[model samples]
Target chain A: MTDATDFAGSSREKWTGFSANQYFICLKGILVREWLRYLSQKERFVSSLVRPLLWLFIFAAGFRQVLGVSIIPPYETYVLYEVYITPGLCGMILLFSGMQSSLSMVYDREMGNMRILLVSPFPRWYLLVSKLLAGVGVSLLQVYAFLAIAWFWDVRAPVAGYFLILPALFFAGLMLGALGMLLSSLVKQLENFAGIMNFVIFPMYFASSALYPLWRVQESSPLLYKICLLNPFTYAVELIRFAFYARIEWTSLVVVLAVTLALLGAAILAYNPARGLTVRKQDMGGSQ
Target chain B: MKLQSRSPETPRTDERAAVAALELASISYNYGQRKALDDVSFSIEPARFTVLLGLNGAGKTTLFSLVSHLFSPRTGRIRVFGQDIDRNSGQALRRLGIVFQARTLDLDLTVRQNLLYHAALHGIGTRVARQRIDELLHAIDLTDRIEEKVRGLSGGQVRRVEIIRALLHRPSLLLLDEATVGLDIKSRATILKDIRALVERDGISVLWATHLIDEVGQADQVLVLDKGKLVADGPVATILSSTGTETINQAFSKLTGITDMNVRGGRP
Candidate 1:
């Protein structure tokens, strides 16, 4: 004879015993949990789709007529500016998308669920990486959706080029995600987030190869051109630009990797429980 | 919930105190130059309800935070069933449950959904998790309102939900830190009765941190705290008898040396 209930109970307990690796597991859980949440918000998908579409339709439409084309590698000759800038705009979208996800971390803190999450028995670093990966996954999906729309237009790249962008996008997303995490770990106040946007966002974009080629900037001003060449976003946009030709830029990939690893490591260090953006207030009494 | 002579060490597995449910030995925590908790030590025994009694700024929450392994302690040890919380926190926390002073339930989730999500975090199987959710709904008197959104619930209802959520994994060492907020008299009594029943059925140990003495007299033991230090700890009867006070209020005031009557009247 079998005690079905008791046996089932033991097995259930055995399963939860695996929660010792809680940080990674909980991070995955939050990913799926928030993914479902993101799905339910019809407005979020609409906005993600619309943001890139507007830039592709309006900004590219106007800029295609003005900017002179340059022979970016893998391009046999000078190509239209629209095709050149599509990946750059996508990079911009992802950069902000990563930061948007970081803002949610601040929101979660105000909600108190963050306390439940951060107090879990898992390693905090793994937990943070899991969250970063989830945000990057969402950003990549939006990028693909934007690319699918681009194919409907005359801006299509080679069929094989689509497959090559995966790793490029991953590292790119990782780099931006690291930046977002660093900002979130440092910026504890919601009111000061706008300060990050004004200071970090536009400067990074205007200084990168997203809007124009590095050579074009050098032709105009040497100092601005040097800043563009040094910017990591330049490497990210360059990765996407090269991948469009169904070829990977090995140098750009290395640069993005180095930057992503260093920034993510820095974010982890800043997020140490002993200091940094840890909760300053403890609830001695119940909810106010 | 049926178990006998539970080992405190392997509480989640054997339903015994496997070791002591929780142990804090010579524990001290510092923030910059200030000490938040100074040499605080206590052990929670199986089936014994212990109340951590203290006032505001008394370092009660700091002690709870250290025990939960939210951050590493500057000095000393925190253990569950003799397992160091830092090194073996996964196994140690598995044996215990905590309801912090803040409301932790996700407002977007229903009562059942909230429990289900927490169970998933703990890696409880879906089938067993569902059954436990239903059991908790009944236990918390929320069976009729299981699907209602948590944001819609009153303060008292949310408190009950937190307790039910904590108990879903059937933790051997349950911690309630000022969990009485927003709860009315009847609701409080109901919650107290349910937890007492759980303690009797499984001999589960509990450490409830609270400022009020009335709601906690049922505790088997009481640890009196003043500032960041342990002032007294013993059986409830013994503590009250030695303090020479009729109630927890008079006793608390007599010990703390601050005889402000207004603070005492707020106790129900």
Candidate 2:
């Protein structure tokens, strides 16, 4: 009706000033969409669990006889290889899920939905943070789902550790998600993400202490041991591993927190409108 | 509709009284070494339907991007309601609504969901957002289809939904870039008429960018862009008379130096 336009115009004056409510609404919208997407694609839930499950079941099962565990701090006695690698596998889920979120960012940009997001009235940093938070939320769900499946596979943490792991997993998920956001900002096209998976994800996954203990890697080579110590993923795995035993690794917690803040800062800078990868290409016609 | 004739160089008193809904001064953009938009300047008055006419690669979309703040201009300044986009982009953007040339709807989301999400982005409350969505869907005659996924809608229906999304925040200025590019003739007419009615009734300023000559009506202001340069800007009648052509189509061809009619088949 013609009167509808008048109603909109009159109502516009009432809502002129900015409010914190707007930020929450925007965040809620983003999170709900992501949740809906996750729900709709049932295969993503299965596949996210599958990668970690394979490592916990088949890979760890093969390495069980080859590798012998020592009395790690959280464990009172020597544990099986599968148990030793559970936290790392959880880190794996978060890592892959983070990259998957970035992949969707690329896809959204290509599909023009990113434009809608960028044009929103909210500050760019708030938008990016909201997106990162949403990614963490989704990845956390996947981590829990994987953990549940691992329980069924006869790999269990202390009952209290399950609760403790929530915060630890949240931190790790945020850090990984932030890293993924940074990678997405640098990547110019969707096709280039495959290169990132090999160059960034795999390297970050393997070179870290995710698959093997740092002490073991040190026994093989001291230089790699140092690298593993420095890898943020190493701290993430350590944080989760300690939490799984109902203990706190202050060192890992500090490292994971510091790395998350740093990566998030970098991600925000990379997504800045004037200097961002996407905006640059949009201005310069994809030559970059 | 009575068409007011005015010279491009003169700004009427009434026009000067109201702040421009959208303004770009000496805006230029470079894509590598190639200039996508040369030093261009124009301003649209509040509540007027202004047509930005350009052929393919004539810098229409580039200008739209600049106005929308998707790409900051290398050389010039853009303002919405007199707010400089570079200095106060958030405020300027708040007063602006944009419908891009590309399809931006999330196909998996239902029509209501898409609209609600957009409303949330603008900070509208859930109750107000739902009411507005219902009103908009009713206005577009797509009320029954609100529950359907966007992918299930016809191309024209999707475009209508996009228009509603842009209008949800009740922005003072609306910019549509090639909004009717792929629509059938009937759909195009409906969309064009609807936007025109918005201008007439709601007093919402519009910058409708397209390369189609037929879309330009007599009363509308026309800005002709040629090879990244603004070759003409005035009312449709003024543009026609200035180019010494009887029709806007011939005027466009004469100004742009394109003689092939098939090449001008409502594209670009």
Candidate 3:
């Protein structure tokens, strides 16, 4: 013990050093809180699932005859449009949940709950990553719920694919959640999330291979195809798609992992107290 | 200037050198082009209620933000109980507890839930946390309200719950930034009384920030901030005598050059 701790007495003993146990406890606390909040707000759960289900049931069904998916690597035979879009719908759940979680973070910031987490004894990066992981956990629940519905609707992958997709969903969710955190750090107000939706969410989703395969987009517009290839969401979707078929797209896996690290790094920097978004005047509880 | 005091009468022991509860040295911070805190520095002694007296935009919240590690100062060092905030932030924050001016409790969660989450963040074991929560709630006379959502509580009750949350980990130094801003007079008094009781019973140092003149007790230490600069620092008696004023309100007016307390500052 340092002289300070000894001099400060027994009350200082508990906080003299950091422990791994405390770290895990903090992580669990964050995850459980997010889970509790997610459960309480049934509307959020329903809305997150509803968006993807709508695209799968209505949009995919309508376009089934029109857009015939060819023999893709993940698909050995000709597949119905709904089956082809299942993984994409899962990605859609992750995408929306990521942004939605970020939206709630902005709301938390506005309402001062973010400050509580920021002021915790843990490192800021640890807190942020835990939050990101918690967001992924919540989004995972939504994705599985959607997958379950799709399965009952006759959009079934191999049983092994169900288990294999867990790791893939985790990575995709992490990458998307990190992207959302990055965007959330930059956003000053909750209302500006609309701008994120119109600018970030829509563009990333539409330009990605989430709805249509990259080859299909290339056949239509090479420029849009280039965009699809460049979009991180595309790799995220492809990663989930391949994993769902008990296959691995090494390129997409590498891309998603790389992007997750990059976005998480940037998000950590953006949330840094020394120089980051938290330094904003409004974040300091307004004028005083 | 008698602006800095280290309880000179107390022996210069190694313990005194190693701790000040909270110490800031030449700290300055800016937001865009405007300065929030400029070369402001002070240290609070252990087991004393030090009032950080500042008006609307006198940078009280900015100072709190720096101390809490919410925003790093552009210049200077901040230490809590002799641990530098930047170099040893975890240690620094470990000993420090803060209640921000803004309401931080999650309105949707029950009081126990909010407090337990904070305990977990501090790494306090669940068993110990439950015991502490029960003790604190009983002390605050809110044991009955533990399960009620924070949204359903009265403003004063919510404030008490937040106070309990801040104290859960047994911090050596407590910082309250305008803690009673929007409460009724009675609630404000009760909260202040409870905090003062903590200082006497628990030997915890407190930095209580507020613009209210009445909050400054006669025996408390005072750090008067004006226009982002610490204008004066000393005991209430010293400040009153130093400024040659009969009362703290008059001394505060003289120090800050604001003759009227009712008038708002230029920044709103």
Q: Which model scores highest in lDDT? A: 3
Looking at model 2, the pairs that clash are: none
* CAPRI class of candidate 1: acceptable
Output the number of the DockQ-best candidate.
Answer: 3
Instruction: State, as a TM-score between 0 and 1, how close model 1 is to the true structure.
Output: 0.87
Calculate DockQ per candidate and list them: 0.33, 0.34, 0.45
The order by descending DockQ is 3, 2, 1
Task: For residue B87, give model 3's deviation from the true position in Å.
Answer: 0.8
What TM-score fits each model? 0.87, 0.92, 0.94
iRMSD per prediction, in order: 5.5, 6.5, 5.1
Which has the greatest TM-score?
A: 3
Q: What would the per-residue lDDT of candidate 3 be over residues A142-217, giving only the tens digit for each residue?
A: 9999999999999899899989999999999999999999988999998888999899889998998878878999
Which regions of candidate 3 are displaced past 4 Å? A1-16, B1-18, B264-268
lDDT of 2 by residue, A1-288 (tens): 112122222222333445666667779988887887778678988899888888888999999999877887778988888999999999999999999999988878877787888788677788888888999999988888888888888888888899999999999999999999998888878889999889988988998877887778999999988888888999999999999888899999999999999999998888775553566545323211
